[model samples]
Target: MATAFYSHPDCLLHEMGPGHPECPERLAAIEDQLIASRIAEAIERESAPLADLADIARVHTRAHIDFIERSAPSEGRAWIDPDTSMNPHTWRAALRAAGAAVAATDAVIDGRYENAFCSVRPPGHHAEPARAMGFCFFNNVAIAARHALEVRGLARVAIVDFDVHHGNGTEAAFAGDERVLMCSFFQHPFYPFSGADNQAPNMVNLPMSARTPGTAVREAIDLVWLPRLEAFKPEMIFISAGFDAHREDDLGNMGLVENDYSWITEQVRRVAERHARGRIVSCLEGGYNLSALGRSVVAHLRALAEI
Candidate 1:
């Protein structure tokens, strides 16, 4: 089956600021690389729909949703946190970003596609149940996981987050829930510094030091994440595909390259094949340096598509 590619033009309109690193150009960069690499034509492309409020409520509080809706500005940007903001287009863009995950889940579950890649933003995995942070408004992966469990009757689902920063929001959503297992690694002593401690049994969070190399990351996955994931035997797998760990990204200090992204994707694909019947849904989270992000995403898609 072909892999599904989900994106929306609204995603490109949710800009943070003039010189923000998490700009709309990120999507264009990926598209350019996809075209240049001749990978765009191989996958099935689809426009993302707006996520339903009912689905959003599954993972976030109604009050949180109401607050974000109320915070949407008519012309200028509204600051939720010092680092996070919402423009006139941000609210709709956020909905589409989360919606892409839900649509991807449906496609994979229905066997319309083997797997899917959602190239939407502002990056999630940082937005908590009641709070938004780290350039995220909604926890897209968390929402998708809940959709698979509650709506699709999936008993077991796994979320794999490889962002350079910890997916604190995702961990918060599924930490105590037995239905989901979240495995991830991040640069410790970094932003939203909370994953190294207070981890629940269902969460496999590995915190690496600054400037850690790809070899160490591979070892952590081999010795830690893989064993736990295999035992979990999830019915579906969701990936928080972040590429900021690339060495060229100024936002993160990890020494990962495109090869690291490809290698890790292969490892995750093996786990999915073994336990989840190759069902996977991946969403964009973080990857700042445009060139590195584009190159890294190509490598990741190559692995996911097995091309």
Candidate 2:
């Protein structure tokens, strides 16, 4: 089977604000690029299902889900925090975002597809288990990893996050749990700065400074991620793929180009091939700046699709 593309129209309905960086247009930009680049025709696409409470409960608490559902504003908007807010559609969109992950995980693990990529958003990596912040609500990728381990019966899985910011929520959910191994590289001293003190034994955290180049990232992957991944021998691989670290993106001070995304994706592909039967389920986490997001995601998906 081809690489599965999982997304939903409701994901676009989760509007933060009119002038917010995480606007609804973000999804449209990605879809436009994939269609224009012919990437859309080359894969299978599925509209994301609304995630059940049980599926989300795999990562988020029942109380949290209840709070988010009830937190929707009747007229205007409700602020979850200074950074995160809920419009009426935010709750449904977050459910579909997490649902896409669950579906992608099933596709990769069940031989339904060679691999999968979740294109839904409110960018889930920064969402903690008990807290919602940084434009995320449900820790979608973390839920996927847990589902693979708990429901799909995978013994070990590795999550490789190369977002501009750390996946603190994912780490919070899976920390101290040896079933999942995580290796991530993100700009330090950035938003939600926390990876430097990662508490998990299987967690390999690489914290770089702002504007760090591709060379520096390659060094960290070579010196850090690969060794730990080889030793762990993960049965499955997941990517918290974020393109905001691209040189053209203004969100972070990083200077990576589209080729940088492809380079990292290629390296991760090798690991999946060698250790996990080329099975990878990637979920989108962050990337603003329409042009950069489009190009970088195209480059990333090209690597995933082997085209």
Candidate 3:
């Protein structure tokens, strides 16, 4: 089976403001790369459905869920956080973003696709069960992980987050749960500095200093993430894919280039093959710098699709 590409038109409607780093253009950039690289022709493209409330409730509290449904502004944009805002369309976009993850999870796990990539936005790695921050309204990957376990009945699941910032919300949701394993690396001195103090043994947190390169990130993969992932033997693998660490992106200083992301995906795929029957669902998290972000994502998708 070919890799599946999950996206929705509503995704572009969830804009924060003018000049925000995590803007609507990030999705356009990736789409441009897929077209330019001719990668778009190779995968199955599908529109994402609005996530079921029951499926979303698996990761979020009922109160939090009700709050978001009511938080969407009727007219002008309403601020949820300093960088996060919502208009009338934002609620539907959040559901589609979360839905993209669920659809990808289903495609990979049910053998309908070899792997899946979600290009929806209002990126969700930083959204907690009860809080929304970092431009995220819902914890998409966390929602998918819980659904894969509770709905699809997978015994174990693994999440690999290589975002510029830690998936603090995800770590909080699944921490100490034992059913899920989270391995992540992010800029330590950056925003939302909490991954370093991982309260859960299942959370393999790696913090990098400014200007750290792929070599250091790779070392972390070899030393910390891989061992735990292999030991967990996840029935399904999920990735919070973020390209902001690329050298051209102003978000974080990891000095990573296109090849670094490709290399990491290769290793992630290998682990999935060994442990999870090659089942993987990757959700978009962060990527700025349009050109670099585009190329980096193409490299990542190429590796995932084995193209």
Which candidate number would show the highest TM-score if scored against the true structure? 1
lDDT of 3 by residue, 82-125 (tens): 98889888999999999999988988888999899999988999
Q: What does candidate 1's lDDT look like per residue over 114-196, in tens digits?
A: 99999999888999999999999899999999999999999999999999999999998889999999999999999989899
Candidate rank order under TM-score: 1, 3, 2
Alpha-carbon runs more than 4 Å astray in model 3: none
Q: Estimate each model's TM-score.
A: 0.99, 0.97, 0.98
Q: Which wins on lDDT, candidate 1 or candidate 2?
A: 1
Q: At residue 290, give the lDDT of candidate 1.
A: 95
| Model 3: colliding residue pairs | none
Give each prediction's root-mean-square deviation over alpha carbons. 0.6, 1.1, 0.9
Ranking by lDDT: 1, 3, 2
Residue 117 C-alpha lDDT in model 1: 98
Candidate 2, residues 1-307, lDDT tens digits: the string is 6888899989988888877888888888888899899878888988888888888888888888888888988767899999789998888889899889898888787888888888887788988878889988888889888888998999999999999999999899888888889899888898887989735697899989988998889888999999899888889998999888887778898888899899889988888889998899999888899988888888888898899
Candidate 3 minimal-lDDT segment of 10 residues: 193-202
In lDDT terms, how accurate is model 3?
A: 0.90
